[model samples]
Target: MASQYSDGTLPSGNIGRDFYIPGLTPVGGEDEGTAFDMHARQTRFNFSSNTTLSNGKALKATIELDFMATPNGDERVSNSYSPRMRIATIEYDGWLFGQTWSTFQDVSVLPETLDFIGATDGTIFVRQAMVRYSAGGLSVALENPETTVTPFGGGGRIVADDNGVPDLVLRYTLKQDWGHISAATLIRQLAYDDGNAIDSTETAAALSVSAKVNLGRNDVRMMFNTGAGMGRYLGINAANGAVLNASGELESIDSSGGLIAYRHLWSEQWRSTLSYSWFSADNDTALTGMGVTESTRSVRVNAIYSPSKELSFGVEYAHAQRDVENGLEGDMDRLQFSAKYAF
Candidate 1:
């Protein structure tokens, strides 16, 4: 996808941590205005294989990569970039092992858009190493664990990788002829230890519900999530999972996010999608400071045309806004174009 960010200088960086300049993201500078970029950094590919066993069981495996989350390259000479791992997994007999999409996320409800992640600010979007078990519609997983925290009275993020227990998730999906719905639960630990001013651990939990409902040749998608210490998994780390108090203790932040989209098939070769996403954090100003983000939202619309199943072209328009606890607000507008072909 090629993108043109306007009305603001959306400086490029790790879209996940920096949030595609969405929620809880700090303004880069005072003169944030229009800028442009045209690239294929979003390109991705994957390889899959299936093997059958003598006992009639089948093993499936896949490995995928994309040019995101890696170190950025200069655009002057070569514009070279590194490929980041997206997924590497193997499944057999209702068991999955390796790094893949988090069990807490419902990928089926995501809308098709030119941006890397259509509902980033309001969706459970995570990929991590795990061991999962599935039977029928129920699934359980033990995923990697880490926590992000903000220093007392406002400071940059501190990724406290000090957890011994993995994050646990339980999900159930109900499928019907018309569509499917999923509900998931996440239980995690938030820990930090600076050895000087901070050393604490806390437990947190969250829940997410998502659905895709069919409407003849069209469909509607939605998701809603609420919890404490799940910010990193939700809005792409728009807000830290917890904040440090005066006593150097971890306090999980309460937050919520949602996404809704509608897709309509204009014809066999034409389709369009409109989507909106939102995120909010309930933070104590005394602990987290008034400069932190309080809320964020975005709306986007796109049209895609595919002459064949393997080839497609698309364009999208998006507007995003964020509000700080101190009452400051910022908004950005963007336009993107994309083309894709697969073999």
Candidate 2:
């Protein structure tokens, strides 16, 4: 179970939006008032199996699901729930095939918080279908491809025309007795063809570096990511990967973001984390539109108590701000409480 109270304007997805860009402020209107909500949608379930192959190897498969999807806005009356797929993967030898965390992301370096992803605005948060190979802390993958584009006039978005190419990602990690470090790179092709003589294509690329250091009972985690046209890959799709210029040509956006978190243990069963994240994008207002998001930032602090490994309780406070290219800005502050039990 969880309860959340938010003050000020926030984007869709409620608390989940805290990690992404804030929604634009209403024209000539003040930000929204305080809002409160509660639910038990974070409960999840998992299934897994392992089989031994004839060649003395092992094959593993797993499927995980959670009830986080809200349909038709009937949370109070229907208490509606939908099964959301979190992970479905198969692994054999050093190869992974199916949907899982993106090759560009390092979950080990993520901060601990009640919110889904602590550093929403700065982290590479993505999960999709891919074929990956791993060997000695090095991994490479070819992931599913889809391009998001802001139209020339910029009222809505358009899907890029199919370009028979998948995203390419490479990552390497170094683990030491004191800490660990990782670096990754991604490249993809963004294309669009309206079929009415408007056709365009652009190449996009991104880089990420992450690290975690141990200090007795405390630790530190951090990540930095930057790219051109890294749209849906970073910042939870806060900006388009590509947008049409005034001449109807495709162009990628430049963005950079990073996060730092520190964890402290007050006792054997009580601990806390303090984290900060920020993201900024260079949007060509004359080409994309004035409504494009310019920047977003957030701060989070949380404490958790675990009587046992199966049950835990936590409380968190988060503050976030967003700015648009047109100079309009909005901010949000939220308090969240959660209790969970694992079987």
In terms of lDDT, which candidate is strongest?
1
TM, every model: 0.94, 0.92
Candidates in order have lDDT scores of 0.85, 0.82
Model 2 agreement with the true structure over 252-289: per-residue lDDT tens digits? 98989999999999998999999999889888888778
Question: What tens digits encode model 1's per-residue C-alpha lDDT throughout 30-119?
Answer: 655655667787788999999998999999999999886556777788978889899999999999999999999999998888788877
Whole-model alpha-carbon lDDT for candidate 1: 0.85
| Each model's Cα RMSD | 2.2, 2.6
Worst 10 residues of 2 by lDDT: 19-28
Number of the top candidate by TM-score?
A: 1
